[model samples]
Target: MERPVAVKTVAADLLALPDWRRTALARFEREAKAAARLDHANITAVYDAAITEDVCCLVMQLVDGTTLDNVIDCADDGRLSVLAAVSVAAQLSSGLSAAHAAGLVHRDLKPQNIMVDTSGLVKILDFCLVKVLSDTDPQLTITGETLGNVAYASPALLGGEKSLDGRSDLYAVGCLLHHMLTGRPPFHGEGPAELVTQHLTAPPPRLTDCGVDVPAGVQDLAHALLAKRPEDRPGSAADVYEALAPYLPAPAPAFATRRMPPEDPQRPFLVPHGPVMPR
Candidate 1:
């Protein structure tokens, strides 16, 4: 057992509510199990979880790291440098690829759920909203409401669709990538209801619109990921990694991070930088 694990404690008030506690703890335990079954360096490891009396505790690997949100905030400006943003997204794609393959869909991915360790290793956290695709149980995601953060929720999810797949998670990765490079999420509104409307109706914006001088290819990738329809996005997380490989700030040492098997050597290489544009 790892010492100094990150332990999540449910608030006493929430624990005292029988209905809320039962539903919340059940989802927490199931998602924790799903995350534990995955073996990806970039995905946070779940060590243990238990509900004692009315309290729920989830113990996870203690990462000596900065939250991705903190990293973004610490940037001299409000956003990450282009290469850094792409590199983070690439690593995240690898982690999500493993989870998707394991039949897990991370429904609530956001910058707050990401961490970059002291060694510059990226790990994704919080699987409390995960859905197990292999189960095909309608009850898994049928709460009559959207389940993820409104700002990052996909159009289908905001529409209260009964089923969501890996593509929905990919949409969030797109939003996360855009946020990393722009210091803001792709969509914004005064409230959750307005945000949902924007996601369902607004056109995907370009990096240039946010006044970031990243490569055109970078913006293009974001657009693909943020496509209003799930089918319009990249086929898989591996495909996303391939699209992002050219912009990775640097190579991983000793292949420490996972990579998809060799693909056609003819993959297109996008230019890494472009002329600086005025904000």
Candidate 2:
């Protein structure tokens, strides 16, 4: 059989695994196809899926740009500029909306999962961890077990919940947004176990505490997205977009200024008498 075209994008190369793992890949391919039916900018494009002698490869679009995680690293003081963060949130919400509409849950959302192309197009990647609502694959629930990225996993997943839906993805988006603006995940500790505990019990440090000027609307959206209980979050991804829309860059043809908002109300109210809020 002919080798697949080489692409520099992550997940471009198929990894060799056991037969059971190959089955998992096949399931992921089917889920990706189901997800592609909902056309959106943030989700990765699935082109083809094939099985080689040793591995199963799912060919996807090669997005050229940096992952959100890397992009945040390049920002001033580690956090993204407010304008840029909002822009990213808007794109992410749109993508999640499409997936939810298609009855799919990303199950894994983090800065590393979001890819921003050189052209400034934001694409959400790695649907290999996606979950389809109606067609619950037996492989997905290995004797009532949940499998997902640990750092971004929802509280319910951590509690050994068997069924996770769109809200789980929203929780992850919240964490991603928090990381984008604060240069750190909302819940972090010495190790993964502590991080999981933080996700379940600890209130995330305020975005402003990170020394960045995030708008109240943006911060509220992040908090809402990061709500501990899935029901406490916005009803859908569209709600998240609506909450974040005001902070996004103004709609211009091109080459428009992307300046930070003057002041973020969600940030602690600056008392003219007290020490000035950190810049």
Candidate 3:
């Protein structure tokens, strides 16, 4: 039997609350517009959307999967295997690259907003906080008004910067990667405000610091993505994808299972050992 298609509609309770109606409606509209703009394999597909005086509706692909938050919680070690983590990161980077190319900045990126299916495919979720990178759409966030999950927010967002770009998403990618491998985010605080301050002023954390034995290159990539200065992170999501390709689970089997042939003294080893990340 075919399952019924899921339709996202404004909650009856929300509609009944006069104080929350306007803001909730605006958020619903923004989410619809943002998801509708992108056509990417790793992004959720929006089929349709509409708004009436009191009701908001969005029809989208029924993603039959759990959020990354649940995946993390279900893991016994509180983290994914290295291959699984890399695969998730690569797919996420591809999706973000496509969105950035289309001038969209996913302001709210976190485990709760990323879905992973049974096939191991990733589908980014929720654009209620998405920002359109354009001159006309000035930053809606004012100074001291932060938006996004504190743990995954970029320094710019935490600092309440008036502008954001693809790098902002890249920062959240770094946080996600760190969490996937280390079983926790790179930084944490006792409260939300302190968490934002940590994002703004804390030094990038290393995967090694958490005892995760991933390749040094992966560790460096995480640090680069989490750089306090946006200019220091990978220039774009495309760059991130390139760096993560070798570790992703595809074309090649498990990176840990591949055995390098022993070196012969007579002939020089043509290929270097592993990916050499830039400092």
lDDT tens digits by residue: candidate 1, 1-279: 437889887778866776676666667678768878988888888888886675578888898767888888887577887777887888789999999999888888887888886556688898878888766655445466568888888898788876678899889989998998888999998998888888999998988988889887888999999999999999899999999888765433433333321210111112122222222
Name the runs in model 1 displaced over 4 angstroms: 52-55, 136-145, 252-279
RMSD of each: 8.0, 8.8, 9.0
Regions of candidate 2 where Cα sits further than 4 Å from its true position: 1-26, 52-55, 143-146, 254-279
TM per model?
A: 0.85, 0.80, 0.82
* Backbone clash pairs in model 1 (N, Cα, C under 3 Å; residues 3+ apart or in different chains), count: 0
| Native-to-model Cα distance after best TM-score fit, residue 11 in candidate 3, in Å | 5.6
Which lDDT value does model 3 have at 91?
80
lDDT value for model 1: 0.78
Candidate 3, residues 14-117, lDDT tens digits: the string is: 77787667666776787788779899978888888989985588887777667988887777688887776877788899999999998889889999999875
The segments of candidate 3 whose C-alpha lies over 4 angstroms from its true place after superposition are: 1-3, 10-27, 135-145, 250-279
Better of 1 and 2 by TM-score: 1
lDDT of 2 by residue, 1-279 (tens): 364432222242433445356556666566657755867766777766665454455667777667877777777788777777777777788888998888888777777778776556678887766777887556655554456777778897777775777888888888878777777778878987888888888886678777767767777777877788889988988888888777765544222223222222111111211222222
- Predicted model with the maximum TM-score: 1
